[model samples]
Target: MDIKNIRQEMALLDDVIPLEGHHYAACLQTYEAASSQRKLILEWFTNHVIPQIPRDSASFLSIGCGAGELDVKILAAAKEQASTIAYVGLEPDSKQCERFTASMALPSDQNIRVETLNTNFEKYTEQRRFDRVLMVHSLYYMNDPERAIEKALNLVNESGKLIILIASNDTLNELSSSFWQMENGGSTWFSEDLSKHLDKRGVAFDRHRIKAKLDITSCCAPESEQGIRIADFIAQAPTGELPPGLRTMIFSYLEATSHLDGEMRWLPHNVDAFII
Candidate 1:
């Protein structure tokens, strides 16, 4: 399979379908099964970001919080530090919202409140500000990421901050960037572009890079059902729906990008956190 041929095929594809809630959930499951990226993110957030937060009392506004996986851990840290915390999560998908809400059941003895809004940032009606506003890997899918950043920044209190967790252009992007370019008619935002935008706008922010790796051993196997799901996730499409030649190229691309470590394949999966 030719990588160059795959790029040409990806460019020929004009229409891109957004994944349904269930599809996204399945993809996430497949991704996490072979990746420790999110675990690293939680650790970094707890050590680096949480320490900078106010310990007395805090309010958290999590934008596009899906399944509340990392948010719950962050909330636990906040609850441990602060006397009270008012946490609100914004998620548009009902399925992920259900999962997010279910995991957010803190102990009754805790002086914390959790609320989930089944809406995006643009439709959120409350004028309430938060101590920390987070958009963890959600900016890419927002209707307008730049505007969303601006609005999220506005919703932060004077002494508070808006934190954005975005992925960097690692080997993961090497596998998916062509799909994104054809789908969006432009390149998606990576850490470099985000930093450049902030610098050009004279926006002051601190950046933290979390280096990590993804185990794509399953993704490298041709007969692994989980591998197909992960390939779908990487390409953001139904792999079964893809043309045979293109699908072969997709797997070939993955095997090419990943480095062999023992019997497993590892792919670079670094992420960046921007504090505004």
Candidate 2:
């Protein structure tokens, strides 16, 4: 499907699937499973990357800042350095942004300001430049990722940074096999050669790999319940419809591998943090 079609279908799914308690719980479970991976990704940035960036830079922008988790983390880190950081989050989902705003308890006295825009980054015009622009695990949703990156590049102040954390195509191929098998097809949004694309564009970036391990058995009853709810929500979507056998297989696969036996493994994602 084209970009327009994908957006329409996603909008429909968002309307049809109410992301309430169960959905949030499931997301939390997913987050727990991926916490280590997330930490590693962030650690790399804080230790190796952020030090290189001048703390005096004016602002930081995180595109698709779902639930503002990363925003909170980054802000907390910057606070430790007594950095007067301004944060801007651009999210496509209004509901998610609202939830994030409601739940966040960032330091009020700190020189940190958080603003979220409820619109697609591609269409949302940026009026000001930022010292850092980040797209974490959210770039694949864009209609034209290259154009999105280009726009992100444009939003950066001179000598600013643009960080993109995307799942490598191979990782998607493994984890989303069922998704790819669906007949209610969509265009492959993932870039198989994302690093090359960035290099060709002369975007200087450092790359890292994050390993996400899911252990089904370790999931408590609450977590499993949330997972089931998420599965149901996902299964009901048009793009999520799969042959019965395949669907069953996917669920069974998820159930069987929840214990982190190292049996169920996804490939490392290509995480690129570019200095523009």
Model 2 misses residue 62 by how many Å? 0.7
Off by over 4 Å in 2: 1-25, 28-35, 103-107, 171-185, 189-191, 218-243, 252-276
lDDT of 2 by residue, 1-276 (tens): 122333333344323322335454455446445435567777876886567656664578888887876667777676666367777888777777886676555657556677877888878876798777888767756767678888888888877778776655542234342233232244334444677787787766777665654333322333355454435433333213434444454455445434444543332334444444
lDDT of each: 0.83, 0.58
Strongest candidate by TM-score? 1
Cα error of candidate 1 at position 109, Å? 3.8
* Candidate 1 stretches greater than 4 Å from native: 1-3
For model 1, name the residue pairs that clash: none
Query: What residue pairs are clashing in model 2?
Result: 1-187, 215-258, 215-259, 215-260, 216-258, 216-259, 217-258, 217-259
